[model samples]
Target chain A: MAASDAEAPGMRPWILMSPALGAVVLLLAIPICFILVYSFWLRSAVGSEQVGFHLDNWVEVLTDRFYRDILLQTLRIAAISALLCILLGYVPAYFIARSTTRHKTVLILLLMLPFWISYIIRTMSWINILGVSGALNVFLLWTGAISEPLQILYNEGTVILGLVHFLLPFMILNIYVSLDGIDPNLVDAARSLGATGWQAFLQITLPLSLPGLAAGSLLCFVLGAGTYITPMVLGGPRDAMFANLVFEAIITQLDWPLGSALSLALLVILGSVVMLYTRFAGIGQLAKSFR
Target chain B: MDETTRYQRLLERFRNGDLERRTFLTLLGAASLGAGLTGGPLKGLQRQALAATPESVRFDGWGGVVSEAFRKYAFDPYTKNTGITVIDGTFASGDEYLNRVKAGQEGEYNIFHASGVFDYARYVNLGYDVVLNEDNIPNLQYVMTALMEPFRGVTGGKLSAAPYDYGTTGLAYNTEKISKEEMEQKGARILIDPEYKGKIGGSGDWRTRIWYGALATDQDPNDIKDMDAVWDAIRAHRDLALKYWGSGAELMSLLAEGEIYVTEGWSGRIAALQQQGHPIGYYDAPNGYAWQECLMVLKGSPLEACEELLNFMLEPDVAIAVAEGQNYPPSLDPTKVDLGEKIPELPAFDPTGKLAGLTFASPAYWNGNEAEWSKTFGRVQKGY
Candidate 1:
């Protein structure tokens, strides 16, 4: 091939990718750099910030037992929510993938409907469902199942529940795409060879869909861990996550420097998880599910 | 050299044919653009045009009924009288709003209805506080001297804000669960009462929590000799609390829905609950949190327009209507301005106008300990 011909193919991809790369650099990378710079500054007694190269915020964020506890709690909540999403989402995903109905598009459309409403509104809707005078208690009262309303809302459980609610669609869609891509002949062959339906699913279908499941798990876990709103709205005082600590530091304490450090700390930890997932499962699988 | 002399020299070079026509034109264009961008006559002209008539001024407040009152009485009428639109915004707390203001560009936040003298002091300390031309705001005379004194104390005897309203973070209890007599007797101690475990509620704000914690420990909130006792008291409240409600709406909802039997709630919010016929009672326990809210004009606001709006808002009719609407007493000294019948009936109304009964937060003491205490409270709140 000519030198120009060889260069054209390589340059074409770069030219095509430039806009997206520029956007990511502008929106994500630049802000992160600013946060990294801000993490070293100091917040004074009167809430005024002193801009300098100081390690107080970093030292505190690294050494503080309080931040460590909240980080662990955040990870625990995110993992629980991701597991719940997988458990609840997989059945729907499989059913949708295998559906012979003409209204399969409608099912996918219905799944996307929740995204139209504001996330804050959706998180807050739990209040109407689980509040003392809410629908659940009233229904329970009418059914004569209990003497009083169950104090079910505003706990770690509700925070996880809210996370699952917000994240289930992503999980379902990812798994559904994976299941849809699976060859019917593979499952049919497994069954034809005297394998039972469950065995066929376990061996042929489930193993093939692992990439999508991993992708969904990563997305759900990252989103859940990074959420401050779910805990602020649905969780009790003790149920605050790592994001809530960043929020309190920045907003309540007016300690932007500390908030920056805390946020970076969270990003680094979550980034390690992403790196591990990429190393094992391959990052291309995540892209494949979207495609 | 000065920009003017440089511009003249460039013009002379251009006219004398020492510079090519294209180069002269390019240089002239660049110089004009630079002057425009870097604050020359063009920028001054833009400022003059904007000041001639500001199209809109933003006014952020605590939202819910408070915002409704401002929208109905103050902002809507102000817009009607003058064409300047009042852009109504809301914040969950002063801290949240302050952080937003810090992140935002100048003039993005115009005026805020801020609570407490500490908030005013913080703004002053951050240099966001604007020295209002009080002579333009004729209605300043009607505001209580006591309310204005604290703000003046913060800003060195010049007001950055007009005293808007006053209320307390008083003990609000469910009348069905706890009697008025019990609330009055138990006072701040009702929060940490073991009998009300899992049934109690409290504000999530560190200041309010710490203030009540001080009262529960029987230590003066303004001067705490033992910090550990306050933290312990707060920890006890945290253990017992059903949820530390974040906003006025949440506080009202918790009480109205019977989620919590007792909480330290905003005086206005609790009054709103009472008016909604929720059987909620309010009591100003000894040294209950008495805070004054202000119409603080921020540094980069349209000064003359903001001053005029401040004056209009403080008008007795407007102030009284807002007071009745929000269920908070207007800062219009009841003695100076004949505040309507309902004004006196509001939760924290001080008819005497002296405000000697209400105990306000000392700005110096609170702001001094703000960084340390707010962080500590954040830890203690999350089960430290």
Candidate 2:
């Protein structure tokens, strides 16, 4: 590769990279530009897209109480789900990362086993597990915990639970990567300085693992905020998220202008969270979040 | 290797004007023909090539178990009656049909099934829906005139879409949970009754929720222009409706589980559920929501062939087969057909006189308030 690079310094690099550049321009940049342009367009009465420029969609999105409330609710739910993911995901990741090579590999493999099945199937399974007349209630009744079936699903509690379940693996893997990168000698040195076990973890381990935590939080928050299925399947009418609004506008009403506007708003709002995270945590940490 | 060498030598000699042209052409044709008849999608194309020039018209409609009935009752029978082949494609709504046509595919499909007034009006307004005449479709006379009036497809009050099977969004309850007295005392207002809290699964697919919510608050679904009051009732009723079903399958699952006691339900699905041995009861509210699916021929489509197909579907035996397969009531006279013995909910639906009570959603009203109503409903859905 080094010899080839030296041999073909004349326009070969640009030629080699052109396909990937074209793909990015075609797939990502163009569609995003389209969404931006369409957000300002209009829907005709005949269900056709009309090309024009208008601020009405933006105005309506900002002024309307319905969009405002749903957006706010989506943010709240996303934040809670992400926090829960961090709280729950940290323990397993710490243990797994601290494990020997063989055990850590097996644990990581076990964590990814459910990915073979679909997201929809996983979410629907929760319904059977948490439905009033479903497995959990049956188990509780059998154990004589209560005579009546508890309303476990179609509520806020179940929605958050489902989201956490969905997002836990991502959080764990991210944190595990960061934890694995931390030199064991650092924690040992902290302990040798007469620091307690908790002190060693708090000083050497916790500070080092912040990058993974931030990355996982970003993934979980963005996904949970935009999730339509978790709410649609597990939660009730009062559980619809912001994605549901965008979907209804585009699919149900065929109102592209409005749908695009809502999508842009969602992206911008969610994007700001990441920017803020990067600022507070440092851009280098956020960049390493994905891997 | 020796045989191949000899054959190459012979072929080389032939190329040098030693072998006959007839022998070469025959060998080549035989080898290609044998392989062509062997396997794959090409075999199907080969069979088509061998058959009579197939007279066919492409159709776009909804898919599911019902599309199977379309094949058994309509497509096969229509093909038998007239030699036209009916190819099928699936689409979600009239929205897709219009979009596909506008994208330079106007001639792709001849017949389409459009539902809801909003869907039908788009085709009509875009000059895509063809005007119908009773001469070609003599069975039009038998269809209930009440179902014939198009939402907005008219030239001085004449309908466009040939009325097909229709469904109503009324309350479906488990008889084991609800009592007859409740039905009589409250009617559709039961949707908002505190007694049924966390027991109702209101369908949250469309603006239909607002219509039902209006009924719960003693407002007429037909004249529900009052968004303020409708939104209020809808939000209020959301407390009672603990589950807002997104699909017919989801609603059916809830009903089967007995997780819900009552909810806004589809007519066909209720009948189908009953047939499936579910002990569910469908009560058609005299002042509740309803929408009918209709047939339309796109302009510049295979009009005559699609017309023949439509007429073939109207025949009693064929129409009955198709409608029964769908578990839906036909648009024809209900008293004439033995529907009560079949669906059990037919007599109550009262397809003939029931038109007065069933409020077909006004397309203009919905299209105008779509964004506002959709956003409101979105909030209600995720109110937590």
Candidate 3:
């Protein structure tokens, strides 16, 4: 082949890149641009939209103590859920990684089984099991474990349970991939030394696994923060999340500008958190953790 | 030669009379068929030839036995007569429907059935809707005069909506669990009553408990113009409420499961639950419940088509069908309806010309203040 032929093959790069680039520009960039434009607009007094542009919506959202408090609450809930997922997911993922090939596949599939059903259905199922007259209470009463049914469904506990149930699989899957990639000989080498089991594992395995744990925690936190259905179905009225407020803004109040501002605020916060994670824990390591 | 000419002349004469008789017969037939054929098609063609023709009549409203009944009896008949299709869209809440309208997707629907409480002057101000054509609705005259009076244009002769269904917001109790007498004895103050504490389940809307608070306190519910009072009332009963159900279906399920013994709800919903084999009962307190649900046409609908549908829905038989089907009392002459004994007489709109008014909550109250209200209620309820 001539030099021109090699250069012609380079043109194939653009050809391959065009479809994804076009899709991103059309689907993501354009909508985000529209939302950016709307976030600065004013809401009509009579309804939810106005014909004029202003910084009122942003100022209101930024300065309002109510929105600030909810934002904090949302972050707190998400952080807690992420921490819980990490603590709960690590052991199972490590076990799965150390298992035989067939056992590993079965264990991974078991972790993934819940995702096959809808998240909403899974969340609502808790109601059937935990509600005032639901199965758990009925069973407890029948067994003489309690005189009256317990009020367990519509509370923060149920919300957390639902979040953990929906998100733990993703965490486990990420951590499992990271652990699977580790050389078993490294553990043997550590064991060959005077290092104890706990010491070797902590010094070698845990630090190396931090990238995967961070990546898993990030996924859980972003999802937990953005989740509306689980909270709406499982949480009580007082447990309304920031996303639910955004939903009410867009769907109930028809305030698109404010809704857009709220959504963008959430995105910015999540993006910042991800950026921070990327800085502290290399993004490349995070990527390999999912490999 | 003379004999031949005479024979030819007679033959010509016979041919002319036969042709004349055939022409006369055709003319007589066409004249007799005139009213049925010419008037019908000609009028239709004239309507079709109009400058602006609606593609269809989009009906955005709640879905249930009532809406279904309205579609079957009223909406279908109108479409059949006028060649317009009724597009049915169901909403889980008034807020949801209003959101669609506010999004400027009002073009997707031509007619919307909304609570009169939710439809304020703002809708008119926003150019989302227009006044109903009185000329097309002759049955508007037959609508119970009380229901008609409230919907008339505020300024003068212009009217924004046509009244269709009227029912009071009252206490709905599972009759199997709680008796009618017991509910009535608790009266409008049932939610706050120590006996019913934690047993009451309220619809998520703030209007239900707010009005009940007004009634229980002997203040006229209609006169509750202050927002503070409404908030206070809601906060007071927040502890007593089991949950704020977002839909009638959810409430019905709760009632069926005996999770809720009593709660404030629309009479139509109670009636619907009763039909579904749930032993639900409704009581009309002395303070009276809110009356709502009116049909309004979007601003740009073909006036003639909208008027026709509006008129058809207002017809006495159609009203009765909607009421009986939806479990709501019809806003028409009760004597004209064969409702049997299912409808209670005391809760019925006073047909005797005596004016009994009910309090209503406008969407304006919650439009801007929902965030604040939600925060306030959340804070107070959480005891923060």
Candidate with top lDDT is 1
**Can you give the lDDT of residue A200 in candidate 3?**
83
Tell me which residue pairs clash in candidate 2.
A237-B381, A238-B381, A238-B382, A238-B383, A239-B381, A239-B382, A240-B381, A240-B382
Model 3 stretches with alpha carbons more than 4 Å out: A1-15, A91-116, A183-209, B1-55, B74-83, B138-142, B154-156, B173-190, B193-200, B213-218, B225-230, B260-262, B274-281, B311-318, B344-357, B361-384
- lDDT (Cα, 0-100) at B87 in candidate 2: 90
TM-score-superior candidate, 1 or 2:
1
Q: Pick the candidate with the highest DockQ.
A: 1
Q: Which residue pairs in candidate 1 have backbone atoms (N, alpha carbon, C) closer than 3 angstroms, thus clashing?
A: none
Error of 3 at B182 (Å): 6.5
lDDT of 3 by residue, B1-384 (tens): 442343344335545774464554454344335423665333322222221436577777787776787788788888788888888888776667667666543245577786763554446656666666688888777666666665554314566677777777788887877787787787867776667766777766544555676776666655656656666666667667666676677777667666778887777777667767877888878776666577777664667788888888887777776766666666665544444555544354545432355544445453345445544544444323
Ranking by lDDT: 1, 2, 3
Report the lDDT tens digits of candidate 2 across residue range B1-384. Answer: 542344456456668887786775455445336536564423323222222123687777777876787788788878887878889888755555565776544445567777776667766666676665557887766677777765433433554557777778778888888887777677877877888888877887656788777776677666665667777777767877778886778888899888888888888888778888988888877676778777777765655666777876666565566577667667766655554455445523554534676668777666666656665566665552
A best-first ranking of the candidates according to their DockQ comes to 1, 2, 3
Model 1 C-alpha lDDT per residue in residues A1-291, reported as the tens digit of each score: 699998998899889999999999999999999999999998877787888999998888889888888899999999999999999999999999999999999999999999999999999999999999899998999899999999988888999999999999999999999889988999999999999999999999999888889999999999999999999889887999999989988988899999999999999999999999898888987776665
lDDT of 3: 0.71
Per-model TM-score versus the true fold: 0.92, 0.80, 0.79
lDDT of each candidate versus the true structure: 0.88, 0.75, 0.71
Task: Give candidate 1 misplaced runs (Cα > 4 Å).
Answer: A1-8, B1-53, B76-82
TM-score of predicted chain B versus true chain B for each candidate:
0.86, 0.75, 0.75
